[model samples]
Target: MPRVRALSGPKPRDAPEPSHPMPRHLRTLTALLRRAETVTLLAVLCVAGGLWAFAALAAEMLEGDLHVFDETLLMALRRAGDPARPIGGPHLEIVMRDITALGGITVLTLVTISAMVYLVLRRQRASALFLAVAVLGGQVLSRIAKAGFARPRPDLVPHGVDVTSASFPSGHSMMAAVTYLTLAVMLARQEPAWPIRAFFVVVAALLAISVGLSRVYLGVHWPSDVLAGWALGAAWALLVWLVARWMGRRGGIEPDRARPE
Candidate 1:
């Protein structure tokens, strides 16, 4: 007698069995590798594009092509016949100063130190070290670039804030981008949730952007300076992130949460 089927139960669907199990396992690995490659490629493109933009801006600035462009924008922020005052009045100037302070050396130093301590406590020594290098490296690069360019600050208006460095790239803006973005990526990569990662990245980006704008608003930096700062900073952060990610995969650094196989 044939075995009786259970009519109330759902019937199992047939899946063909491969003669070897290797192919099935290989397919999953292949898919994972493809996804990883795609992501890395995109990151490389972003880094390259940012560097290219920075170069273009630098060339134009050196040729004096951005002089009128920078002057027009900088002067527009002042009150008519009052190059000493910003258009938004004393209160707006105050607000801008406060916002700009977010990118200042004191604030960034405090933030980086705090983060490094937290990472140390968490035993993420490699990541903490990487963050430090990323930020400090950006600072070094900023100083070198400024010295190389030797560009002067905007003299079109009395600066809303004090500035004493070369004005080709706003140090505050560049540091803000480097510190915030690097920290954001370090924190985001450790988390498994996409929304959490997105939140960190978005907030970091906004902070960097606001700092750059505040520089221009304060009349301490040429518009091109802020733009160049952002470009270089972003590229630096991404390049460091790529290196960190690569190291993480090799177990040379604190690895991210394991990718799905």
Candidate 2:
């Protein structure tokens, strides 16, 4: 009885190690990546919508359903007493001529060439190449659109400027949006401040819009034509921007923030 001892219970297995929480920085990065993906998806959807809208408009125009609307807008810009003259006086005509020139091949090419040179000198070769592709591709697309639709220029009023191409989409309007918007985005990337970026974008939009309006005011293009040009041009620019961003993130191109000094 003196040596009687109680048996000890069997020991329990050790608990599995607690899983470690993800580091805060890693979590933040993951969230940012997710947000970027969401933004890209939205951008793609918008591009599709813009394309669909252009197609629908083109179809309607081909069917002659848009003639009334197009004619009304075109005629509205002309003087009531004289359809041969635009609503504005001769002075205004001169101003519009100057504005329209901003979107012409000469001016657009000069701007694009200058931008490319600057980007190249800054060691942003990828961006420079992309810019060249975007502008040149836009030109090709504009030509194709004109050939495909082959809509004649409005004859309801005297043209403010000489034009010979099919007029479903205004070349000046489309190229203006492409050139100005592309330049704006490239410039915005160099700025860290949101306000500065917004300013650049607004200015670009204004320039594009004014060019489109000038085309209509000059009686060279129908309102629908200008609208179609704007929609398609904006979509193309946005598509290029998305591609550039995606490439940058994948290390195919340098990030804007990491530009060489």
Task: Give candidate 2's TM-score.
Answer: 0.86
What is candidate 2's CA lDDT for residue 182?
84
Q: lDDT per residue, candidate 2, 170-253, as tens digits?
A: 899999988888887776766667678779889988999999999999988999999999989888888887877878778876
Highest-lDDT candidate: 1
Q: Whole-model lDDT for model 2 versus the true structure?
A: 0.86
Over 4 Å off, model 2:
1-24, 258-261
Q: Rate the local accuracy (lDDT) of all candidates.
A: 0.89, 0.86
Model 1 lDDT, full chain set: 0.89
* Candidate 1 collision pairs: none
In the range 193-239, model 1's lDDT, one tens digit per residue, is: 77888798899999999999899999899999999999999999999
- Output the lDDT of residue 58, model 2: 90
